[model samples]
Target: MKFEHVILGLLSWRPFSGYELAKHLEVEGRFLKNKVHLSQIYRLLSRMVDSGWVSYQVSVNDGRPDSKIYRLTASGEQVLRDWVTGPYEPSTRFQDPEFMVRFTFGGPLDHDALLRLIRTELECRRAQVARFRTRDRTITDLDPIEGVDTAMVDRVRELSHLHGAASIDAWIDWLQRMLTELGGTVPSTG
Candidate 1:
């Protein structure tokens, strides 16, 4: 998802200054998988305002610099609603922030669709694990040729596979736990 959409989602909750937005990104929004630069928040906000997705009001403070408070526009709310119900593609289960952003707005979303998203994500992660295992196997089974550092290559590949495997495992664990918490049983992987 675009950074602008993330900003809109936050603003949907309430109005905030760029500083507050930055703080939200640093703390509550960390699950987003990517961090927005504090310096870039204002720049992005400017673009968002130009796009008509958001608008701001300048607020005067006593003995302090005035600040611009941002809020979602009607168009922005519609855009956010579209994003919430739009088809979700977990393109990269581990790195994508779309799921977290969707979770942030979960209160107003369909519970069944959310459950389907979790199941789809689980399938994607399982496929990732399979790919990792295949790569590891291929790395292990490679025949050494002359002047080639097959051992070093194998070691690097093994580490990469392990890292990928661990990430998928962690995601799977989290998905299962979420399912349990939602009073839904995890589907059998067998």
Candidate 2:
């Protein structure tokens, strides 16, 4: 996931102090990313400022160092909109965190966008299932190898495929549910 997009999304909600943003990552936003160091957050914030995507004001406290509070600028809003509505290509792995981030931040922004995301995912996962469901698991001993069991290798491969299929099937079902919740019809898997 592009970490900057997450930052832009959060800033769209409201102005957040650097400390508040870090706390958000530690708490509710942890699923998007795990344990972002404070220094890294500040550096990204500085970059955002330089890019004119966000502007910050220093808030001074009595007998303590000042803090930077960040809010999204107009350009930042447009950048975020572009990202939210942008093309999404699924990673090779299923249940990727990027999907969750996009869904969480983009779904509320627009219904059609969410629908598009769900449809794309559903199509891809269904294709994956169709492609992987049946395969030629033929094992050949063309060359003599030491300590290798073709039967064992075949069994392990089957087990791994089964595990992956189960997980992806569950993911598909969940996506279908989400589509229904969004008032969109689920596409036929046939």
Candidate 3:
């Protein structure tokens, strides 16, 4: 997901100064972005302003620097809506922030769009589970250097594979449940 989309999503909540934006990102919006520097937020805001997607108004404080409180322009709203309603390409990393980001922003904006996003994620994760659930995880050592614990390596590899498979399966199950709640058809897991 583009960083701008994240910013747009935040703005959709309410107009915020750059500092507030940073604070929001650090707290409530952390899932969307773990760590974003203050300067980067300002820079992106400036770019959005230039693109005619964002506009800001300066607010004077009694004993502080003037703050530019940012808001989305009509163009920005359209862009955000288009992006939310557009196709979602699932990330290979099952727990990537992409799903959370899209859902947080898009789900509230449009119902059908939310269903589409969830459906896309569900299908992708289902495919991933089918592809990797029972794959052979054998590790072949070819002339390994001394001191390498081949057995330990194999155990770790198998554990990691199992962990990933289980995580994706759980995600798919949640998606199915969510689709049901949203009145979307839950596809067969076969």
Candidate lDDT (C-alpha), each: 0.79, 0.87, 0.87
Per-residue lDDT over 1-190 for candidate 3, one digit per residue giving the tens place of the 0 to 100 score:
8899999998888899999999998998888887999999999999999999999999999888889999999999999999998888888887678788888899889989998888888888888777877787675655668997878777888888778777777887888899998889987776
Ranking 2 against 3 by TM-score, winner: 3
lDDT of 1 by residue, 1-190 (tens): 7777788888988999999999988998888746778789999989888989899999999999999999999988888878777777887547577877776674345576667677777777777776655652654367778887987887797797788778778888998888777666788886
How far residue 144's Cα lies from its native spot in candidate 2, in Å, is 11
TM-score each candidate.
0.79, 0.86, 0.94
Tens digits of lDDT, candidate 2, 1-190: 6899889888988999878989998999988987899888889999999999999888989999988889999999999889889999997777787788888888888789889998888889989888877876565753538887767777887898788878999999999999999989999888
Off by over 4 Å in 2: 138-155
Top-down TM-score ranking: 3, 2, 1
TM-score of 2: 0.86
lDDT preference between candidates 1 and 2, better one: 2
Model 3 TM-score, all chains together: 0.94
Best by TM-score: 3
lDDT of 1: 0.79
